[model samples]
Target: MEERIIIAGFGGQGVMAMGQLLTYSGMVEEKNVSWLPSYGPEMRGGTANCNVTISSDPVGSPVVVEATTAIVLNKPSLDKFETSVVTGGNLLINTSLIDRKSNRDDLNVYYIPANEIAIELGNVRIANMVMLGAYIEITKAISVDSVYKAFEKVFGESKAHLLPINKQALEKGAEAVKSLVNA
Candidate 1:
């Protein structure tokens, strides 16, 4: 299987981190993967995006012109990347910050109130994690166990203390996706 994904939002929203986690997870599962990140000059609040490709075969390129999936965390990202999704691709949107919707009918769209869910979970900074969890559930491209291992690898010993909350965010995101799918 080959899946190209783009995750985008403002910097400090964990867009790159999310990409890192997915890449790590794919590595743990022994999948060929690539991650490339881009950000504007303003740093924290600047626009940030990353392209991630996971494949069962060797990956040839890291640049993603048309993605198989898009996890858009803001309205601007939606505006920029919505059209970049290939036909019949997946689009996971963070609805808490975005009031708009994708008008395309060819794609499978999923929406999550990531920010609000993170806030409800007592950590507003984990909005990206929430979105990640939802994407995992919807796509089943990577296993939850692999994601846990990814967390262990990416966050390492220094940030080990944050694992519980991060796992919670992932579970919350998966649950959110399950609800949407069931509906």
Candidate 2:
């Protein structure tokens, strides 16, 4: 089970966080994982993305030329990585930020209202976590339990107080995707 994932969004939107969460969660599950982050010059409000590869076997490279899944958080990201997803792969779009839908029909496309959900959850910062939850539900690439375990390591122990809310956001995202697919 090899999952090559491309997660793209504007800087400060936690694009790298999502990638890292996935990579770390994969590691917790004892899977081989690689994470490569890229971003524009500006730290915030600029283009930022990451390529994550998780598999049962050794990862040949950290770069992902073609992704098994593409999670796009904004319009520009959607435009940039929509075609990167392999046929029959998953394309999870944050509908809260991206106004349009994908033109491709070859993949399983899920439009999740990530930002809106995070806002509803009382913190817009967890929007990335929402998307991460959606991806986990769709792919089952890593267990939700692993994600919770990796949170403290990723966000650090000082911010451990935020764990409960973040966990809610992840569950909300998973619920959101389940409804989307069930519909």
Candidate 3:
């Protein structure tokens, strides 16, 4: 199984971190993975995105022009990468920050209130983790357990205290998607 994903958002929104976590999680699962991140010079509030590929076999490239899934964290990112998802692909949109809905009809679109969920979890930074959880539930591309194991590798041991909340964020995200799917 090969999943080519494009995660886009404003800088400082944990776009690259999500990509790295997915790559690391894939590694933990013994899958071939690749992560490529890009950010504008301004960073922080500037645009940022990453391309990730997880597959059973070797990854042929890290650049994803047509993604199997597109996780958009902001309006601009939604506008930019909405069409980048292949027909019948998945589009995970963070609706807490985006006001509009996707125009496409061919894709399996999921609207996740990531920021709202993160806020409910007591921190807005883990909004990305919320979105990541939704992606995992929708695709089953990687296991949440793998993500837990790779957490320290990406965020470092200094931030270990944050794991419980992050885990909650991931679970909340998955639950959110499950409800959406059921509804």
Task: Tell me the tens digit of each residue's lDDT in model 2 across 1-183.
Answer: 999999999988898988998999999999999999884475557789999999999999889988999999999999999988899999999999898989999999998999999999999999999999899999899999999999999989998999999999999999998976666
For 149-175, candidate 1 gives per-residue lDDT tens digits of 888688788988898998999999999
What TM-score do all the candidates reach, one by one? Answer: 0.95, 0.96, 0.96
- The superposed Cα distance between candidate 3 and the true structure at residue 59, in angstroms, equals 0.7
Q: Give one digit per residue, the lDDT tens place, for model 3 in 59-174.
A: 99789998999999999999999989999999999999999999999999999999999999999999999999999999999999999999999999999999999999999999
Cα misplacement distance, residue 123 of candidate 1 (Å): 0.6
Q: Global lDDT of each model?
A: 0.91, 0.92, 0.94
**Window of ten residues with lowest summed lDDT in model 3:** 38-47
Better of 1 and 3 by lDDT: 3
In candidate 1, which residue pairs get closer than 3 Å at backbone N, Cα or C atoms, i.e. clash? none
On lDDT, the candidate that comes out on top is 3
lDDT of 2 at 11: 82
| Model 2, runs deviating above 4 Å | 39-44
What is the descending TM-score order?
A: 3, 2, 1
